[model samples]
Target chain A: MALSHDEVLHLAKLSKLTLSSEEVLHFADQLTPVVDYFRELNEIDTSNVPETSQTTGLVDVLRTDEVDASWVLSQEEALSQALKTHNGYFVVPAIFTRTS
Target chain B: MNIPLSISEVQNDLVQKKYSCVNLVEHYLSEINTQNKTLNAFLTVTDEYAYTKAKELDRVITDNPHAIKEFPLLGMVVSIKDIYLTKGIRTTAASKVLESFVPQYSSTVVERLESAGAIIIGKTNCDAWAHGASGENSDFGATKNPWNTEFVPGGSSSGSAVSVASGLSFASMGTDTGGSIRLPASFTNVVGFKPTYGVVPRYGVISMASSLDSMGHFTKTVEDSEKIFAVTRGVDGRDSTVVNHSYKAVSPTQKFRIGMPKEYFAKGLSPEIEQKVRAAAQEFEKMGIELVEVSLPHTKYAISVYYIVQPAEVSSNLGRFDGIRFGNNRDSFGEEAKRRIMLGTYVLSSGYYDAYYGKAMKVRSLVIKDFDDAFSSVDAILAPVSPSLPFKIGEKSDDPLQMYLADIYTVAANLAGIPGLALPAGFSESGLPIGFQLLGKRFSEPTLFELGKKYQAVTDWHTKKPS
Candidate 1:
């Protein structure tokens, strides 16, 4: 089944990506076949099968709560790669735009 | 000085004082200067850093010859895939999103390799976000196959394979999420070994698919692969998935039972690849090893299952690239990355989750079980790395599904979390490299490497270089 343009846009929205109208159509065209290809999984009977979140059987692998200095990035290093930062905190556009 | 073939030769020459460490670094850097223009392999060449490292090593060689043994990788030059973060170096992952991003810390693998005295020549190019099989998806440009420039060097470990194949570096660090390392290694005729998942810690490496990604490398010889593996594998405390298991060298006199998965050799595999891989299996038979014909029934569903599971993880892993921390906003992602993200979102979306992501996971269990059953009978499974030989650069770029299909034989190992070693089998009639992979049970790298070493012992395929 081909993904409609609106469906593609919904995916883009959920993914936090802004796509052009052309990209919406393009993605719809491209992703339709891939999604259809994924339908092949329905043919298999996996009712009793359990989900595998990870290959390694290790679970709840925990370390001591103490901080190790070697891996700790200083405040300067932490904010180093940000495009916008102020007073040691990353700056971003307003999460809520007010409209009245 | 001519480029040495293996790490042992480099170590021997360094000890013999045939050439200084600086000469070796200079030779490789010069080769990069000459070949990289056409091959488009290296994204960054660390001439200053390499020289500094080499000078420091030269001092050690001159004064503390006894301590030289401590540095197993002394005088060896290696390359890092752009996906691996090198401290203070720009690691792009071949995407414009992180184009100018300089990492503050190096990966565990990098830190270990450097400590073992490996001189990192540079960061090599790869598919953007490691989303594609062919290197054409790289944001910078496609990495050309060293054998035939018009043809592709299979990716997402494109430049890593090309670097080792063309002698630009002795070995290269790469990630194999879904045959990223093995496919390229097959295309370029290098030994690409993807250890079992969590064998090499994933900390400091750019995430593709969190669950599927396995850190691996490319080398000229199986023994060189073993040396690099020794330095890289271990728990680094950061990546919680890493298991603290040391490598055990296989006995030289050890015999083996190799499996040929019937499903892998079924229809759709290129006849030439089938013949070459069969010939490789025959080589094992000649070594007095048993070749059992095994069956993996769920093999047909591997590619479909991977598309679901890998993208689901990719979507989650890539969500961190929000421009606030490191890279540019979502717009900087290439077409392939965007497509994967969107696909991942669609699958993991509310109503469709169980149908797609949930189902893929269950099928993934079946795929893993197939390997478990097969391993009970045979020590390792030998199969073609790719269904076909390397095609021309522009051939599969237009079709994403066609490109994903190229990963059929390789994704199974990643899903099963098994160790796979891709060894050069022979050359095609057209002279492109052909390779076959040995898949062993989890943490069976020693057995796979032993098989690879035995194969390389009689066959000169690994010695043949691309002209």
Candidate 2:
């Protein structure tokens, strides 16, 4: 099924992406056939088949809840790559802003 | 003196005092400086880092000749795909989002390789976020196929394959979530081995599809690939999916039976590729091995299931790159990356989750079962790596579906979580490289390597240069 422009825009919003009007049309045209192609899976009968989310058979692999020094990233190092940082904390766009 | 072709040769020359490790590094560095403009294989060249390591290695070679034995990859020049995080080095994943992002820590693969004395020459280019089957999806620039610069190098491990094919590095590390490693290897005429899922830890490598991604590498020879695998494989206590197990080494003299899956040779495969791959299989029969015709009934559904399951996971993994902590804002994402993110969001959304992601998982189980049933009858499966030889640049880039089809023969191995080794089969009439892969049971990497070595023993295909 062809995705409508609005549907494509909805997906873009959910994905946190701001697509251009041209991109919305382009993606709608590009993704429609791919989504339609996914219909091929419906041809197979999978009534009783269990989902295989992970192929590794390991389950409930537990480790002690302790810090591992080797894997740790210091606060300074973690904030080094952020575009905005203040007092060793990552700064993100404000979620709530008061009106004047 | 001529450049060494394999790891053993590089070490032998070092031991013989034919050339210092610094000389070797300089040679590869000079090659990159000259050829990278045309090939666009490397996104970043670590000239200073490589020179420092080479100088240190040169000291060890002079002071304690026997100490060189301890370092398995001593003096070996290698490259990492831009997707892996290398501490203090810029890792872009070939996308503008992470254009100047310098990782604070290195991947487990990088640390392990360095500890074993491998000198990382640079980070190679690939499809942004490891999304496409052709190199054209890279945000930096498409990596040119060394054999014919006009043709595309199969990707998302595009530049890793090009580096090995063009002699920029002895071996290059790449991640294969679908056909990333094998397709590029096939297009560029190198040996690319994708180990069984969870065999290699994905500690700091950029996640594409967490469950499906397998860390692999490209090398000029199967033996060299095995050496790299030895250092890189095993559980690192970081990635929970990594299994702690040992692969039984296959005796070189042991006889074997290989299966040729009937579905893989079905319509749409180029007749020339079929003939060449079939002829390569016959070389094993001449070695007194048996070949059986097997069937994977769920084969046709692999690509469709992959598109669904992979994107679902990609949507989840990419959620971390929201520009809050690391990479640039979502606006910097390339077109292919945006398309995948949007497609994934649509599939995993509330109303469609069951129909897309949930149903795709059930089909994935069927794909796994197909491999289980087939492996029971034969020790391994042999198939063409790609349906056709490398196409020209811009040939299939316009149509995403056509680009996805380039991985038709390869995605099944990733879906099944089996180990696959793609090695040179022969060259097409137009001189493009053709390759075939050997698929084995989970953690059967040793057997696959042994088979690859056996095939390489009789055929000179892997030895042919891109000239």
Candidate 3:
């Protein structure tokens, strides 16, 4: 499936990336052949094989029973990592300048 | 003895207090200071902690020497792959995206190795996110081969293998999804071991193809690899993929049976490498081992199957790497990574998932069945780790398809979830190292180690200097 320009933009947003218009066009070209290679996987036959949820033929990985505790970091500590924070959380520019 | 600088010579020195743990730490760190610039093997060097730990160990040795005796890796230095979490230290996976990120916890393997008495030298470089077989894919500058200045040290475990090969550290931890460990080891004339799938825990490791990603080791010798595995193998509650199986402790039986796959011996294999592999086979025969020709009828399609399955997993595994989680912003991520993500996404998307990921998984089953059949009649399978000797750095770097095929010989083991060991075969006439591997049954590493140690004992292939 050739990636649509809008789909690429959506994926980039989902991936937390912001691509310029020219860069998007260039990336679209580079992503074309790679997508074509994966398209070949559609020809494979998996009907007889059990769906592999995970390798190691394993299921039901249980979490550790032991509970460990750690010193808590305050909101001040959490917000220390950001260049901009509002209240106690990191803040970023709106996804869009304004809602239409 | 200067406290026995190399791992092979250090057991006795460490056993006695003549060299003291403090002295050995200083010795290796000093060597690294002078030698690391030329090798470019480490991304960080943990000198302060190493010295402090060494001094503390000295007090422990004085108070209770017996306690320290249980530790086999005492006073050893280990270089960690950048992908594993090393709480408080950066773990970037060679991508620009997580430059400032540090994990809140340590990886299980790192904790185990530290408890075993090995001091971490620092995190090392890899192909970005363990994506490629060559270190060139790194967001960090490429790691040059230690042997020759102009060649690449294979990747995505590039710095790890180069560190051990050039003696920047005693050994290094590397992850192998598809020849990432062995490819670089072969290039540098070191021993790179991929434990049987599920043998080592992968929790806290930056996952790459969760089904195939294996936490492995890079060492200067096969014996050292055995020691590393003995300490690192076990069940971890963190990685659900880890198997509960333990390898047989015994070595190969008398009249060992080794098989060569006809598929791996076909065209595109260099005449020199073919000759080297043949000689190595003959040497095994001289050791009273049996060499038989085997057919893995499905081998021809192993690469095709691997590309489909791996990229499909890459699509899912890498979904978290949007600019927010890890990895660079769209612009900072290298071209190769973007290419893989796009390809993977396309294959797993609607109308294509069944065709690609589904078919690849089916073919994977056939490949595993092929190994099961072959191993029933043979002790282990031997083949060239790579079809050709190391090529010049830029020769195949630009050609993605040709570069992907470089892993053709090594990917089957990953596809089948088996263990493979890459050891130096011989050198090309041009002085580059060539390597061959012995693929063993799941959890049958002792067999490969025994064979590798014996071969290394007779030939100095493992000892030759690139210079």
Candidate 4:
């Protein structure tokens, strides 16, 4: 179960995190022991047991289709925290660039 | 004159005109100013906001003295762990990613606490994303344990415990995903109570493990913890997981059956901590209570299950911090946060989902069932909050597994979605405080409170404060 370097990079990408080369090497060192230690779970027989996904026992609590005026964050307030804004809209990196 | 005061004492003093609310707040402010530099307990102090709120409370109290009854926490000061979102206030969650992120809205808990007339003086430091057991994981800086500056404050609710322990605030709110609240409470010699899951709404709290996280608080005394729990526990529409469980006040049983989990005392536990916990449990025998040796066989696997399940949820929960939303890019995550996210990503990945995430979930059921079986035979479970006393600052920081092992006795309560209270049991030989945990069935917080208050009645350990 030791993670390869490429696999670690893939995970970092999937996690939307960009790790430095040193961090990649560091995480590679750290995650191996952690993942290897997690092998303790293999010793236990949990063949037919059900998974405890949500423990609260409440299921699909549907609220009424109405707006609470107080809970709503105003447009100005919502956009206030953004580091970059343009024309009252949050500015983000372009998903697509015409580099070709 | 500057001695530690419980929340009730401060409230009573405010009502009796012993001091004005503004002066009381100023007193705490001055204490924070003096101690925060050394303790590093606070991340952001809302001095202007606290003063304004206190002045308003003073005016109201002057106009009509009995008006204080309307606000249970009238003019009382409290601090919040940075994990809670504070409106218009910079909440870092002790991560560089949200270092300058000022939340647009406050959490429901913050709203409730503020409206109840409690003045929020500051947001305290915690481990980044509530990821580490030691406060060293905080991106801002590690919070020092108030009892001894050189020792690390147990975390990720590290500063909350220190703030309360040092009398900077009457009480402080913290979220316990595993042992965040209790362990710090134990280490700092304060009462930390984690109510049954979903009892307190988690609407605006920065979530670590959604399913396991319980919003709780640290207080000078168990009675204060009970009072705060009464004010904050309820259902919120924003958090769909909240259950409408009514809080029924329970009294300490004269002939109660308290369980001492045999596995909890087995190995890796400090003999000193064991002796302190056992001495506290024996007090029940003196009160005509039966102490049964119960076994939670699946307890050994809790830390493994927690790390797996928690990181999986963290990976999903932290996805919102993608730079485009509000904070910096995910690249700003600390080593611990990155490790958790990557581990989560690996577990939930295509080929490994069933082996890792799925298997952990099934074992989680076994852990929950172990608690269910144990509770059927005993009214509550008593155990040590940590394996050993609070070590020096850098003792466990190097080895992550060693740090995770510190949560062995505390995580099962989170996994089972039950109420657990950490009460000051005794002091170590070197005078560091130790706390024993009282765990009850789901929604049995009042029972735990009853026992906690009862314990505090006979012992003065909760009254001892750091120099």
Candidate 4, position B33, lDDT: 97
Clashing pairs in 4: none
Clash pairs (backbone) in predicted model 1: none
Better candidate number, 1 or 4, judged by DockQ: 1
In Å, residue A97's CA in model 3 sits off its true spot by 8.0
| Lowest lDDT 10-residue stretch of candidate 2 chain B | B60-69
* Regions more than 4 Å wrong, model 2: none
Candidate that scores best on DockQ = 1
Instruction: Output the number of the lDDT-best candidate.
Output: 1
> Looking at candidate 2, what is the lDDT of residue B275?
96
Judging by TM-score, tell me the better candidate of 1 and 4. Answer: 1
CA lDDT, every model vs. true structure = 0.93, 0.92, 0.77, 0.88
lDDT of 3 by residue, B141-193 (tens): 78878778688888889999888777777789999998999899998888999
Q: Could you give candidate 4's per-residue lDDT for residues B326-385 as a string of tens digits?
A: 999877889899998999988899998998899999999999999999999888999999
| Every model's TM-score on chain B | 0.99, 0.99, 0.95, 0.98
lDDT by residue for model 2 over B119-188, one digit each (tens)? Answer: 9999999999999988899999999999999999899999999999999998999999998999999998
Query: CA lDDT of B291 in candidate 4?
Result: 95
Ranking by DockQ: 1, 2, 4, 3
